[model samples]
Target: MSTGTIITGLRHRFRQLNEKPLRDDLIFYFAIIAVASVLFMALPLLTGEAAETDGMHRAWFIVAGTLIVLVQGLITGAVALLAVSLVEHFFLLFVDVHREFEKTMKSAVYALAPLILFSRAVLLGVSFAGLLLLAWFCLSTYFGVWIFHEKSKDRAVFVALATDAILAFYLHRWTVGPWLAL
Candidate 1:
């Protein structure tokens, strides 16, 4: 699909997060995750200092780097899916919402469309844009959860904050920590 089509689809999905039969669309969801993961993983190559190595060494390095990016991307995507599922489950405890786990997870993943698209700016070191994108991500994530729960405005805000915090902590521990070690 075209970029415009994807963006339009995401916007439509965002608006209808509260409606019935939330589309799982695993193919699209996984595609977004894959693209974001690959792009994020390749940021180092795009912005890192150039090495003074020979041809073979460079080739090997590129191959190794590509493999690493692919593997990490898949892992990060899977972790994110699981994280959303867990967060939704935890939130359901206090709230009286009646939503299916799979639908909730789909909402959570689809809501990340903007952040995934904006991630390129963050990876490119646009600090101000990155910060705005971060805020947008948090807000979108909150809305996603709110749609599923149909809770009060205050409760929805709380759920969003709690979900973002939990997701940030989990991702930092699993994804960022290891990346920083490299």
Candidate 2:
């Protein structure tokens, strides 16, 4: 599918989420994520690095990096989906929601599409834009969960923010701790 089509579909999905039934097409969701992953993987190359490098080394590096990114992105995406599913399931126990587990997963993935796209641009080196995008991402995530849990909108936002904070803490601890020690 074309980029325009995908963006339109995502916009429609988010806009009509309350009115329409949740989509059941796993393949479509997978395609969206895969395309996002490819874009993310290519960010470095497209921005400037590809122009900086020349000859065989550049070719080899691109090939290797692309493979690594593809594999890592898929793995990370799968793990994240699983985590979201589990978290949703846990949340469902206390608060009854309209959608099922799989449907929730689909919605969450759909919500992440914009985030994935914005992150690719950020990765390409726009710090200020990245900061703005990050704020947008957080708001979008809160709204996404809020929309899903119609009866418990406040709870949904709380859970989303809390989990995000926890994730950030862990990421910072692991990723920055070693560098700081030096």
Query: Which candidate has the top score in lDDT?
Result: 1
> Tens-digit lDDT track for model 2 on 61-176?
88887778777877777777677556644655555665667656754565455555565555444445544544554555555666655546676666566645544464453333
- Cα RMSD of predicted structure 1: 6.9
Candidate 2 regions exceeding 4 Å error are: 1-15, 18-29, 46-65, 92-99, 128-134, 171-182
Residue 145 of model 1 has an lDDT of: 62
Alpha-carbon TM-score of each model against the true structure:
0.65, 0.60
Give model 2's TM-score versus the native structure.
0.60
| lDDT per residue as tens, model 1, 1-182 | 99788756655665675554434445666777677766665666677764556689977987777778777866767776777767866776566667667756765776566666566775555535544654665676666665555567677677667776765674453324434655
lDDT of 1 at 77: 70
| Candidate 1: stretches off by over 4 Å | 1-12, 15-24, 41-50, 113-125, 128-131, 149-154, 168-182
Instruction: Please estimate how well model 2 matches the true structure, expressed as its whole-model Cα lDDT.
Output: 0.59
Global lDDT of model 1: 0.64
